[model samples]
Target: MPEENRTANFGRGVFVHDVVIVGAGPVGLFLACELGLAGCSVLVLEREPEPRSPWKADPLGMRGLSATSVEAFYRRGMLHPLLKASGVNDYPGADEPTSPRGVGHFAGMSLDPAKVDVAALPFRLPSPAMEGVMSNLEAVETVLSERASMLGVEVMRGLTVSAITQDDEIVVARAGEHEYAARWLVGCDGGRSTVRGLAGFDFVGTEPQFTGYVVLATIADPEKLRPGFNLSPAGMYLRTPAKEYIGMLEFDGGAFDRSQRPTRDHLQAVLRRVSGTDVTLNDVHLASSFTDRAMQTTTYRQGRVLLAGDAAHIHSPLGAQGLNLGIGDAMNLGWKLAATAHGYAPNGLLDTYTHERHPIGAWVLDWTRAQAAVMRPDPHAQAIQRVVRDLFGTRDGTTYAFEKISGSSIRYDLGSEQPLVGRNAPDLRLEDGTRLGDLMRDGRGVALDFSIDRRLHGSAMGWESRMRYAAGPARNDLGLGAVLVRPDGIVAWAGDRDPDREAFERAASHWFGSPAI
Candidate 1:
C-alpha cells in the first residue's frame, strides 16, 4: 500500500535493517548520519513534509552540541551547501555586510565549519574535508539526509510511523502501508513521539510557567545590534514611546500563536517591564507562540525499541538546547546501535543507555528549570538567575558544569573510576600541532595514545589501535588530569596515573567490544 492512502497496523512490520530510525527531524537525521559513519547500515523514516518548523531556519549561538555532535559534523564533511541552500543572502548593503553580523554571522556560529574538522562526518565523503558554515534548519537536515544516503543509509521520507514492536532479534515499525524491520528501532521523533506513545512510556516533566515572547522578524541593520544582548537574558526588551524591541526568550511553556498579536501597548509594556525601554513599533512581520516544555522520558530504551532526541526529552528552547540535545542523543546512541548490530556489544551494554541518559536528562531539567524559575517576573528572582548566569559564564569550572548540562561537559562514569570518567577529553594537539578537532576526519571514534612516560605498562594501554594515546595535552581545556574517550565522545576514564585495567577494561569492552585490545 502507498504511504498516503494506507492503513497502519499496530503489530504489522516488514523488512528489518540493522537499525531503523523514526522521525526525520534534526535528531533522527543526525542519528542516521552518525550510525552510517560508525559503519552501521541504517534506515530512517520520516512523516514530515520537510525538516524544521514553519519559521525560517534561525540560528542562535547554537552551543549545547555534545562533543559527540561535534564529532558527527566533522565526520560528515558537511558545510558549504547547507548555507546557500537554506538562505537567500541578505547583504544589508555593502557597507553593512556584517551589520546583521550578530544576526547571521554569530548566527552562523552554530554551523561554523571552521570550528571543527570536516572529517568528523559520520560517513566518508569523496573529499577529505569541507569548511563549516551556518545553514538553515531545513537545509542542514537535507544535507544530513544526503550524507547518510551516501554512507549507505536507507532513507524513507514522508512516512509516518504508527507503531513499533520487538521480536527476539529485531524491532518492527509500521507507517501506514509501509512496514519495516530492524534489529533496533530508534525513535528520534519529536516531543510528540508516536513510538513513545506506542511503547506506553511516560513523558514526565512540567511546562514553562510563564509567557515569554520571541520575535523572528528581521531588522534593517542587525549589525548595529550588540552581541552583548544574546550574551545573557538581561535587558531583553527596550521600549520607546513608539517602538519596542525585546530580546529572545524561551517559550517557557508559553504559546506563540500567530492569531494572537500583542497590542502595541502590550508590547511596549513588556519592553518597559523587561528591558526598561519604550520604543515605537513598526513592521510586525511575524509573531508566533512558544512554550518551554521541560519533560523527559523515564528511560531511553525498552527491549529492541529505543527512543532518542526529542523522543526522549523536550524542554525550553532557552539557549537553543533542544536541537543540540537531540543531536547528542543521536551521537550517543549511534555507536552503541552499530556495535550491537555487529554483535560486539556486551550483554548489558544496551541497558546502560537508559541508566546514563536518564540521569543526564533529569539533571538538565533541574538546571534549565531553575534557569526559568529565576527569570520570573519577580525582580529578586530574576536577579538571582542573572548572578548564576554570570557565575557560570565567567568561571571555567562553572562554565564546564553548564557545558556538562548542555551535554558538552558530560563524562560517563565509566567503571575506570578515573577522575575524568563521564567527561570529555581536552582538545588534543597532533604531532604537527593541529588540534585533535582537526584530526576528526569523519567523526569516527579514535583512540589517541598519549603516553608521556615509557614505564607505564598496564593492560588498558595495549589497546592502542582504537585510540590516539600520546603525550598529555600541553594544556587541558577540560581541566582533566587524564582522559580516555568512548567512541561517541564520552570519557571512559581519566587519571593521574594508569587507570585500573580491570575497571578500564569494563568500559572499553563496551566501546571496543572486547577486553583491552
Candidate 2:
C-alpha cells in the first residue's frame, strides 16, 4: 500500500499517522525515512523551528560514523549524497579491501591505523562503505531530511510535545493547542529529553566523572597548546586543525555548572589547568558543555511510545559512539516498527527491537565509562592508562579496539550456533557483479542462494513482498551456500555446502511471517 493511502481519518476530524516521531534530528529523520520507505505515514515534530544551527555545522558539530553506520547509508542508497554533503571527494578502494584510513581515539588516546590487522577481522568484504566517514550533524540530517521529504514524511517544526497519551491502539501527542495522533510514537530527542520523561520511562545510569567542553574561541597564543589530542596529569585537551576549535576535559567530578554558558575567563582557567599552559582566550564564540554522566532508559519502549538516539542512551562524546549507536538503533527498529504498523509482522517481532538493541546500548555506555575511568586525573587511573597505552601499542590491541570502534564486533545472540547467523551480512557479491547492498535499497529481507540449482527460489517466492531472492555463484561465498539477511542487514541464518530449503523456509517464516499464497 502507498504511504499516502495509509493515513486514515478516524471518524471525527482526527487523522492518525502510522508513526509520529519527536525531534527531527538525524535519528528521528532516519527512522522517518525508513518508515516512509516502507509505505508508512510518518509525521515528525521538532522543537526547533529552524534546521540550521551553528553547533550543527563545522568543527563543533563534527562526528564520526562507524563502518557499520556507513554501510546503513550505502544499503539504503544514500551513500553518495551523504559523502558529497560531508565534503568527501570519494571513498576509495571499494573493489579491494584495505586498512582503514583512520582509527578514532579511545578516550583521548589516538590509535595508529597501520597497526590494525585488517586480515584478522571476521566476515569483512570489499565494499564502498568499508571505511568510516567524518561528517557533521547538519550534513547527516540534511541527507536524511531530503530522503524523508521525497518519501512523503511530514515534518512539523517548532512543535514541542507537551503531553503524550496512548491507548491500546493509538497514541496522541499534544503541543500547545494542537494534537497529533498516530498509531505509534517515538522520541528521538536529545539527552535532556522531554518525551522520555513524559512517557514515564525509567532512566538509570552512573553520575558524571568529568565535565567536558567544546569551545570555538580566539586563542591569543596559538602555539601555547599542542595540536591534536593531549593527555596531561591534570586532564585532556584537544586542539584540532581548526585553530579556534578546542576540546577540554576536567576531572572536577563534573562540577562545572553546565546550566550557565561557559565564560571566556572560566574556559581559559579550565584550559590552563588541563593543558598545563598559560593559554588565553581573546573571545569565546561558541561553547557547549557535556559530562561523562552515562545514562540509559530501562526500556526503549513504553507502551506505544518508544525512544531512540540520545533519548534512549547518553554518554560523553568520548569515542563518538552516541550518534553511531543511535543510528544503529533507528536502523534496527525502523523495519520492525514499520512491519508492525503495516500489520504483517510476525509474532514477537516488535519485542526483538529491545532484545537486540538494549545490549548494544549497554555496551556503549560501558565503553564510554571505561574511557572515562582511564582519562581520570587520579593516580590509579594514571597507572591503568600506562598499561592501556602499552596495550594499544600492539597489533592485537589495535585490532581489538578497531573491531569495537568500527562496530564490527557486534553480534546479536539469535539462538544460533552458526557464527555468521547473528552478524551483519557483509557486502556479499555475486559472480554477475550484483551486491547485497544494491538489493537491500527497498527495505526488505533478502535471501541469497549461492547454490547452482537456485534451490530456495520457490520458498523465497512465497514471501516476495517481504523478501528479495537472488541466486547465483558468489565471487566469495565465505564458505556458505546461502544466507538469510533481515531487512536491517542482520544475517538471520546461514546454510552449508548444500543449502536446505526447509531450513531456509523456517528462517524466512520466523522473520517475515507466513508465506503468501
Candidate 3:
C-alpha cells in the first residue's frame, strides 16, 4: 500500500469532489447518500477491507425488491435498527409453499402496492442512506463508513481501481498506489466491473436460469419453524431471523447469487425439502454463496465513468428486481448526478442513465424471462407450473405483470412530458397531514402545487422558491390530479386536469433544463 503511502487526502483539504464513488455497494451507498445530500463532494472507492456483516456478501435481491425501496436505504442514517427492521411484516403468505410445481398460486394474483392505482401508499421514501446501505453488508459497511465520514464523503479502503485517464476535463484515477482525480466518476463496481472494464461499457446480457445453492440460515425456533418456513407456491421465504437461523434462501433465480449458486447437493436437497417428513439437518447456524447474474449496461455513462449497481445490471433473482433496480439506480442517478454536478443539469442530464436505467434493466430482464419461463423442468413446464400455480395464485400472471412492469409502472419514455404523460405521481395520502412518503423527505425536489386542479387564480409564490410546492385540492391520496414533482421523486407533471402558468413553465423547463416559475 505505498504509492507515497497511499496518497492520504480523504477529507483533509476538501477539494476533490462533485462525485467520485466506486463501490460501497447498495448502489454505491445510495450514490453516497445522494451526492452527499446534493451539496455534492463525494468519494467512496472501497475494495471491502470492511463493512456489511453477519459475515456479509450475499443477502440481497429482496424477493420482488420493494418495501418502498426498503425505506430509501443507503445505510438509512447508519442503521436505525436497520430502519426498525424495515417495517410491516407477517412474512410470506399468499398461499405458502406449494411448488411441487405450482408457484404459490401467482402469489394470490399479485397486486398489493397496498392496492396499486397510483399505489395506495403503504409508506416508504425514507432512506437513512437506504437503511444504512442495507445494513449487514457489514451494516452497510458501517453505515457507509460513517456516512463517508459525516457526509464529507471520502472512503478509500484497500484502494484498488488500478488505472483510468480522461483529460479534456480531468478524470484520472489509479489506486493501488493512489493517483485519484475527478470531475465525475462512479462505477458502483460489481458484476465484475473494473469500472465497466475500464469504461469500455457494454455489459449486455444473457445466462442464469440456475446456478444453485442459496441458504441464508437463521432460526431460533421461529415459532418452531412456522409451519415449515411458510412461502412456497414455489419461492420466497424470510422472517428476518432474530437469534438463530431460518429467514432466507434463494435458489435458482433471485436468491443469493454465486454466479447462480446451488449444488452443495442442491443445497442439501433444499435443506431436505424444508426439514420435514422427519426433519434433521443439524442446528445449522449460517451458510454462504453468490454469483447470481443478469447483466445490463448499454450505458450508464462512459466519458467520465458511471456504472451503478452490480455494475449497471446483472439479473436473475427474478422478481427480486435486482436490488429494486439498484434502489432505482440510486434515486434515478442521484438527482441526475446532482443536476450534472450542480451546473443545474444539461450535460444532457448525464444522458439519462442510459435513457433511464436501460428500459428498467430491459424491463426487469423481460419479467425475469417470464419468471424464467415458468421454471421449465419440462413436463409441459411442470404442467404449466401446475396450471399457473393452482389457477393463478401468488398473483401468477403477475397481474399481466402488474399491468406491464410495476415499478409503480415507470413512464419516462423521454417524451417531453406534457403532464407527466402516463401517470405515477401519486405517492398519495396528503391533507397537510404529510405523506407522499412524508413529503419526499428532503430529497429536495418537488413542484406538485396544482392549485389543486380545476384551475384557479395564482398562488405559487414563485413555486415556493424552486421546489416542494404541494398545493392540495385537485386530488391527493391516490387520486392524482394535476401534478409536478421532480427533486428525484420523479413524475414531473401528472394530472387528471389542472393546468396553466404556460404549462407549468413548460414542464419546468423540459424537466429541469431551467426556467421553472
Candidate 4:
C-alpha cells in the first residue's frame, strides 16, 4: 500500500507516538536510529514519495565524514557497512601506493596527509577508522534507514507536515488531513523547513557572498576544461573524476535565486567565466545552485518542537561540514531526548542540546564564512589565500587545519578540568580484545574501570540500567584509571588514579540523572 494512503487511514485520529521526526534524510534517519536503539517509539514523515535520486548517488552526492561522525558510526556499528558500500576500505593508510588516500581540503587548498603531525592531537585514539571517509549521500541515507528499520522505526513517505500545534504534554503534527501526536517533534527537514517555519524559530545569520553551482551534464568538447580543480580570475571550478559532474563557485553576492530551475546555457556561461574556457554543455542531467549565506536558529528547541540538521543551521558546503554537523546534532540530542521521554532526564539535560550544539554550529558557520572570504576573486582575498597556502605547507598549520576540519579537536566544556573529560573517549582496546566502541553498540553509558578496581562499579550501582559497568586492562590507558563514557561516546569524567567515588557519582548524576531510588 502507498504510504500516503496508509497515512490517510489515520485521518483525524489521535495516534500518539513517542516522537515524530519530520524529514527522512540522513539526519532524521540517524536520529530515529538512535532513539529506536534507546527504546523510544519513533515515526518519520518524509515529503518525497520515494528515496532514490540520481543526484544523490556518487560523484555528485559525495560527502566527507568527519572523525566525530565517523566515531559516532563506529560506536553504533554503522561504519563498516558504509565503508564497504563506498569502497573506502580499499585504502587503509596514506602510505598505500596503489590506492588513493583520504585527503582533506580547506577553501580549495589541499592539505597533504604527509604534512599533518598526528602526535600533536593528544586525545585521538588509534583506530581502524581513518581520519575521514567519503560516502554518497544516498548510501548514508540507505545505511541509516536500514538501521532504523532494524530498530523498529516507522517511516512514512509522501507525508508533508502542513501544520503543527503543541500543548504542554504533546505535539500534534498535521500532514494534509492526517494528524500524528507525539511527546516531541523534531524538524530534520532541509534548509526550507516547514516545521521550523511553523514552529516560529528565529533564524538569524549573514547573507551570501557567492552563488555556487553543482552540475551534471555532458560536455561537447571535454578538452575545453581542465582535469582537476582550477582557480581563475572569476572563481573556482572542479572537474571531478566522474566526467559528468562539475562544481563551480561564482562570487555573485547571492543574486541567483535557487527557486528557479537551472538551465544548461546558464551553467555553460558560468563555467566559461570561472574556468576561462568556452565549455559547451551539450546535455544537462541535473543542476543545482547554492550560496555561502550562513544562518542558524536562535534556539534548537521551542517547547515540544525541536530542530536538527539543515533546519537548525545552514552554511556553504565548502568543507562538507553541513552533513557532519547535522549528524553530530542527532547524536548529541538523541540520548538526552530519549531519557527525557522515558521520564528520567535531569533538570537541564534537554536544554543542553542547544547549549552544547549551538556553539559548534556557530563555529562551523564562521569557518565557512572565513573560507568564502578568502576564496573570493578579489586581489585582497587572493593575497590572503596565498598566505594561507604557504601556512598550509607547514607542519603546525597543516595539523591544525586537518584536526579542525576532521572534527577531532572538538571538546565540550563539561565543567571538568580533566584532559579527557568532555572529549571523545579514546577507542581503548580491552584485554579480551573487545574495543570500547564495540561495547557502545547498544547505546548505553559505560562505567569503564581500566584497572579492574570495581570501586567505580559500586558507585555506579544505582544507575545500573542506564550505565553498564566494565573493568579490564587496556593496551594503552593513557594514564587513566577509570572513565565515564556517555552513550554518545563523550567522556563525562576521567581519573588518573583509583576511582574518585564522590566525583564519579557527581558526574554520573550530572549526565545520567539521579539513580533509581
RMSD of each: 9.0, 1.3, 18.4, 4.1
Provide TM-scores for the models. Answer: 0.70, 0.98, 0.33, 0.95
Stretches off by above 4 angstroms in model 1 are 1-13, 51-56, 59-68, 75-135, 217-286, 383-408, 430-445, 450-484, 494-507, 515-517
Local distance difference test scores for all models: 0.56, 0.92, 0.54, 0.86
lDDT of 3 by residue, 132-215 (tens): 122234444455456546767777777779778775454767888666676788888777778888878877677654443335
Off by over 4 Å in 3: 1-18, 23-174, 183-212, 215-266, 273-318, 338-342, 345-405, 409-489, 494-498, 506-517
What lDDT is reached at residue 74 by model 1? Answer: 51
Give a tens-digit lDDT track for model 2, residues 265-319.
Answer: 9999999999999988999999989999989998899899999999999999999
Report lDDT (Cα) of residue 259, candidate 3.
Answer: 52
**Residue 183 local lDDT, model 1:** 70
Pairing residues by index, what is the TM-score of model 4? 0.95
- lDDT string, candidate 4, 360-410, tens digits: 999999999999998899999999999999999998999888778878788
Error of 4 at 75 (Å): 0.8
Q: Could you tell me how far off, in angstroms, the CA of residue 111 lies in candidate 1 after the best superposition?
A: 21
Q: What C-alpha lDDT, on a 0 to 100 scale, does residue 236 get in candidate 1?
A: 42
Off by over 4 Å in 4: 1-13, 91-100
Clashes of each: 66, 0, 78, 0
In order of TM-score, best first, we have 2, 4, 1, 3
Highest-lDDT candidate:
2
Question: Compared with the true structure, what per-residue lDDT tens digits does model 1 show for residues 1-517?
Answer: 1222122233444444678888777778778877777666688888866555645345321223333343446544553344356453541212111111221111111212222222322221122121123445666677787877788987777888877767776677878876787777888878778999997787888956645555534344343344333322332432112122344453234644535776555544443444433434445554544456688888888788889877888776554456656766776777777666766666776777787777767766676676566665567866675566554444343433423432444655655555555654444544455554444445544444344552223644644544444444333333323445666656565544443445445555666666443
Q: Which pairs of residues clash in candidate 4, taking residues 3 or more apart in a chain or in different chains?
A: none
